[model samples]
Target: MQLVVARIGRAHGIKGEVTVEVRTDEPELRLGPGAVLATDPASTGPLTIATGRVHSGKLLLRFEGCLDRTAAEALRNTLLIADVDPEDLPEESDEYYDHQLMDLDVVLADGTEIGRITEISHLASQDLFIVERPDGTELMIPFVEQIVTEIDLEEQRAVINPPPGLIDDSQAEVASERDDA
Candidate 1:
């Protein structure tokens, strides 16, 4: 599958180069000459890299055929993707990709299956796990070491001890009060 690594922001200069907001953790390894990138959900063409360099912490990219400001401007907001082999990804014992965590079963410390992970959000302070219950209710659980005790990626399960006043019943009551108001 192709994973998105960057998005074309704007035309950097008149010479076919565009500024990119990098999404990958290893930007240096991903951007280089002769690299192939696919623009997702918009242009269907596979963009072949003519040149790439980091300028002021952002990636500057020039496509093989794209020349001049007009051609480069046309690619604004295009997501750059590279074909990724799942096996090629590094295995961190505790850390996991957001995509891998999504839709995994979320169980409590005592072995009660409460929900499935629907999304993983990165906040200013920490990561948040959005778990969705069978009844369609969503719980925003903070991904803290104390709360999220264990993550078994091989088993596709996360063991969590939810903080006080964050359970399904308490959250539902809070939602109900908001609705009533």
Candidate 2:
């Protein structure tokens, strides 16, 4: 299993140090020195981390053989990938990798089938699940604890307790339904 650990940003200085936007939770473990990572273009790497540090709250990494600003700048926008075990769980028990949640059936707390998770979108602030319904329609649901109540890997299902107007088209309709009941 290959996971994106970081994305190379612009060159920091005249040295080979380049800024990196850390993607993985365990940056020290994933992007530390001596770690070799693959690249997105597949030709730019595998980049071996010669040195790394935190500067101005951003990760700075210098790859072996990249000795100058020109060499570091050439790696801008390149994704750093780490090879991990398929069964490797995150350090945090509550967290999950994107692959773990993919293909899981999505259901309401009442067991109403909504769809199956087709993709997990990692956004800036939060993640979203792209669910495809039985009819081929799809919906994007925020993968927050308040909405996604439970994830049963063995059951291969995710139980959602979406707020009003989330699964439904209109919040008014959902409110009215509650009133009628």
Candidate 3:
């Protein structure tokens, strides 16, 4: 299994270091020096991490052979992928890998079948579950504790307690009207 560890941002300096937006929880293990990562473009890398450091709360990394600003700039926005065992679980009990949640059936508290989780979007604030409905439409549900009440891994399902207007279009109009008032 290949998991995204980081995405290369702008070139940090002339020394080939580039700022990285980390995607993994274990950056030290996944993005540390000596780790070779596959690239999204599949041409820019297989980049080997020569050095890594945290500057101003951001991760900066220098890859082997990318020894100049121009070389580093060419890697901007490239996703760093690391190979891992498909069955690898996150260290934390409450956390889950994207692969674990994918394709799980999503249901409501009252056993109403909503959809299936097709994708997981990792945002700055929180993760979003992209649930695909039976009709082929999609719903972006925030993967927060308040809305997502349960994750039954053994049952292969997620129970959500979405607030008003989240899934129902009529409820959304009511919510909009209330906000205007």
CA lDDT of every candidate = 0.82, 0.91, 0.93
Best by TM-score: 3
* Residues 1-181 of candidate 3: C-alpha lDDT, one tens digit per residue: 8988889999998999999998887899899899999999899889999999999999999999999999999999999999989878888888998878999999999999999999998898989999999899999999999999999999999999988889988988988899999
On residues 76-122, what C-alpha lDDT tens digit does candidate 2 reach at each position?
99999999898889878899987788899999989999999998877
Candidate with top lDDT is 3
Regarding TM-score, does 2 or 3 come out ahead? Answer: 3
Q: Taking the tens digit of each residue's C-alpha lDDT, what string does model 1 give over 1-181? A: 6677888889988999999887665666666788887777545468988998888876799999898999999888889888777666545666766666778899988889989998877676988999998899998889998988998878999999875567757766777788799
For model 1, the local distance difference test gives: 0.82
Name the regions of candidate 2 deviating beyond 4 angstroms: 118-126, 132-138, 176-181
In order of appearance, the predictions have TM-scores of 0.76, 0.85, 0.88
Candidate 2 TM-score, C-alpha based: 0.85
Task: For model 1, name the residue pairs that clash.
Answer: none
Model 2: residue 148 alpha-carbon error in angstroms:
1.1
